[model samples]
Target: MKACISRWASEPFRVFFPLGMLAAIAGVMMWPLLYTGKLGFYPGEAHSRVMIEGFMGAFVIGFLGTAFPRLTGNASWSCGELVWMILLWATTVASALNGQVLVADTVFATLLLLLSSGMIGRWACGNRDTPPPGFVMALAGILGGALAAGLLAWNQKYPLGFTSYQFAKLWLNQGFLLLPLMGIAPYLLPRFFGMESGHSFHDSPTPPPGWWPRFTASVICALLIAAGFALEAFGWSLVGHVLRATVILAWFASETPVFRRGKLSCTPGNVARFAVVALILGTAAAGLWPLARVGSLHLFFAAGLGLAVLAVATRVVLGHGGRHDLLVGRIVWLRIAAGLLVLAAATRMTSDFVPAVRVSHHIYAAWIWAAGGSVWLIFVSRYLGRGEEEPS
Candidate 1:
């Protein structure tokens, strides 16, 4: 038992990713009841908090915990560090389930703080090799997560106007999360497609030759988006999003050959490429028509963030285990789940235009989303831990 636990601790994703997926399914499953007042608590708040901080947040932690040390060429996490995080995360999930918002938020904030500190400490204590630009962006995301957590805790404790929490939420999802997603995509996608050139998980890619300019621009665009939030300038933020989207679109186009070279069909990476396109269109639509902001944004969440997380999680679990064949061969249900997610996004967006059917559409969308999440929990849950790597 001790040996197994220690091994599991080494690959944090083994513990967190499946937990995140289950949380995602449960959150969506319950949304309709909450929205319709069949349940007493605030469904929107609880659901959003769980899906963002719990579901997606878990993957972020697992991936970063597993990858950060490697990126910095530092020592892997100590046993104590992994155990502590596991306890804290488990407590957070329990707290959220029991409607202990204050407890959940507080615990989550502490977790983010600890994670950020650990990442920074690793960089500070490691060898003198210059870290990649992606590492820096990841750190920025961790900082943003910390700020978002603090805002949530404050709002729960002091009852400040919603703006602070709202801004924090926006910062967490749009600015912070986007940075790492964009930064890591350049590295992760080629591996997903099994490209002959570029980086593979086994062989870390050389940092892009023109790293500084690209990193700086990404930072500037992210900052502008945050500034728009601070000033409540939706249009300005949309401009930043558009610029970001354009860059991502270009990157996708440039990498088409690499994608084409891969043997996998409907692999997570390929699905995520479509997700990126959805994100671009969603941002554009939200910017163009203020009335459709909420609806339009779901396109990014469901298709972009939602599918992207699944893809990355699938790739990480399979790739690290040296079972890349499963991704293309037996994972047909994964493709179906991805399609359902796109449908869910479309259904939810259409609801905004059809007010008469909005309530029904929302429920339908929720069910579709839940079903999509359920597919992963049923199929991939066992594999998450099977790939745990021994400490280097």
Candidate 2:
């Protein structure tokens, strides 16, 4: 048991990815339980909290914890750090499950602080390579998450004014996830599409001459994204949405091979492309149909960010496990999972637009999302610790 855990600790993703998937399952399951009268509370806030802070947050921790150390040539997360982080994550999930939003958010803030401190510590003092320039946005996203959590916890104790509340929600729902996804995509997605990423690390201790300029660009983009969120919070929804979407599209086009035809078009890469489309469309839809904003945002949450995270997680697991063959091919299970998520997003949107069928559609969407998460988890979990070992 000790040896098995040591191996898992060596690669944080081996543990946290599965935990994130399970949190996603649990988060979506709340709706079904509520509509069926199995749950006593409405679970709206709790569901959102769990999905963002518990589900998405776990992936952030896993991927960054696993990748950051290597990126900076620092040590991997110690076993103690891994254990404490997992415990805190589990507590946050449990608190959210019990409808303790304040508790959940507070715990989640602490977790983010812990994660940020470790990564920042490595970046500041460690030897070897610098992280990608886009990581400036990634760091901003992490800090945004912590701030969002703190705001939420405070709101639970004292009512934030309507604008303040909206700002908090926007930061939590869109800013935290969107920033990190865009930040990481430039550095990671090119590889998925069989294109060379220009952000590769060098052997020299000092960063290359042009690194700071790229970092400055990332900082400017991050500020633009935050400004967009502020605009939305101040009731300029359409302007904000358009600005955010345009910034993301422009950044993606500049930083990634998103517009170019890559040599490869595999499952993860294809899904990632779909995610980008969904993200832009969904953001625009939220502005275009304010009355159905809830449903439109599902496209961003369930299909856009959710699918993107799974796709990246899939590639990470397969690549690390030496299952290069799987990465190049269309994995049938992943296709099914992606299809299910799309359906769930559509169903959720339909529920918002058509009031008569809202309850039933909500239940259906929840179950569909849960089913999709299960399919993804089942497929990826098999390769977790199997590194380079052929399946029997």
Best model number under lDDT = 2
How many residue pairs clash in each candidate at the backbone level?
A: 0, 0
User: Across residues 365-386, which tens digit of lDDT does each residue of candidate 1 receive?
Assistant: 9999988988877777666656
What TM-scores do the predictions have?
0.85, 0.97
lDDT digits (tens) for residues 239-275 of candidate 2:
9989988887888888888777888989888888888
Best by TM-score: 2
Taking all chains together, the TM-score of candidate 2 against the true structure is 0.97
Q: Model 2, residue 108: what's the lDDT?
A: 90
- Compared with the true structure, all predictions reach lDDT values of 0.72, 0.88
Model 2 regions lying over 4 Å from their true place? 389-392
